[model samples]
Target: MDLSEIKGRIREKSNIVDVMAEYIRLQKVGKRYRAICPFHQDTKPSLYIDPEKEMFHCFGCGAGGDVFNFIMLIERLDFMGAMKLLAERAGITIGDIEHKKGD
Candidate 1:
């Protein structure tokens, strides 16, 4: 499979709410959730996460994107690093497996 396909699968498998919850306290609001924006000095719950949409947006800092983008920003990691981390969390294997399996 292509790397993009794997990335898409990882994104789909990894829940945005669950990932954000691991880093910050999320309060349930209606069908969505809210939290203090980590990107800026936020006293209020500026960070809003919509689990149904699998996306997040921070009204304070204007930070918004999918789970991968969130991980990159919050974790202070590069795109590939975030991808690797999320891939492991989602139980998605990376690199060659068929060759290694035979060995």
Candidate 2:
């Protein structure tokens, strides 16, 4: 699959609330969940998780995205690397883990 296809798959499989909760101290806030941003030093809980959209946004530092984007940003990885990372987390295999996308 291509990068876009991989991103789509990751988005479909990712749960925004769950991924955010893993890295942040999250709390239920009205219809969404809030947490301090992990990408940068944050206070006042500027990170928000919208489970309905399967995405997160950080008002403090502008960090935002579906889980793939989150992983990419957090891990300093490219799109394929992020997909492979999440695929491992989800126990979805795509051939050799060390293989590049088109290799």
Candidate 3:
């Protein structure tokens, strides 16, 4: 499959909360989940996760994005690297990708 197709499959199979819970603790708050931001030093729980939207946002550090972007930042990896890892986590096989610098 092409790269975009592979990414779409990975996203389809991934549960944002389930995937993030593997890295950090999440507390349910009404309709959303709240957690401390792992991207920066935080005094309180600033990251809010909306499972319905499949998105996360940190008020303190201004870090916000979907699941793939979260993986990119937290793992200190580029887009392709995050995609590969996410695919593996979701049990989606990805074909070989030519990863080069400044991607």
Candidate 4:
């Protein structure tokens, strides 16, 4: 899938807290959520998840982005691969969109 389409899908299906929860034990912190960074070793919960922005940033390691970005970083894949993986998780058929886009 293309960048915008992937971004749109991520925006639709992902909640920042829920996505972050997959990798870390998140606790409510003020308006946002906090967790330890999974990408790097940490002890004091340096990961921050902004649900309203649909973004994550690590205060310790500087990794940041939306759900797809998290997937790309953790899975070590490029954008399209992350999109396909997330699309499958959401049960959205990428092939259908691909077919329509070609027309």
lDDT of 2 by residue, 1-103 (tens): 5455555666677676776667668899888988878888886889888888888899999999888788888789997798788877776665634445564
On TM-score, the stronger of 3 and 4 is: 3
In model 2, where is the ten-residue run with the lowest total lDDT?
94-103
TM-score of 1: 0.89
Each prediction's TM-score against the native? 0.89, 0.79, 0.89, 0.82
Per residue, candidate 4 scores C-alpha lDDT tens digits across 36-64 of 88889898988888888888899999999
Residue 51 accuracy (lDDT) in model 1: 95
For candidate 3, write residues 1-103 as lDDT tens digits.
6666777789889889998998989999999999999999987899999999999999999998988999999898998899989998888878775444544
Which window of ten consecutive residues has the lowest lDDT sum in model 3? 94-103
lDDT of 1 by residue, 8-89 (tens): 7898889999999999999999999999999999999999999999999999889999999999999999988998899999
- At residue 72, what lDDT does model 3 achieve? 94
Could you arrange the candidates by lDDT from highest to lowest?
1, 3, 4, 2
Score candidate 3 by lDDT: 0.89
lDDT of each: 0.89, 0.78, 0.89, 0.79
Worst 10 residues of 4 by lDDT: 94-103
Q: Model 2: number of clashes?
A: 0
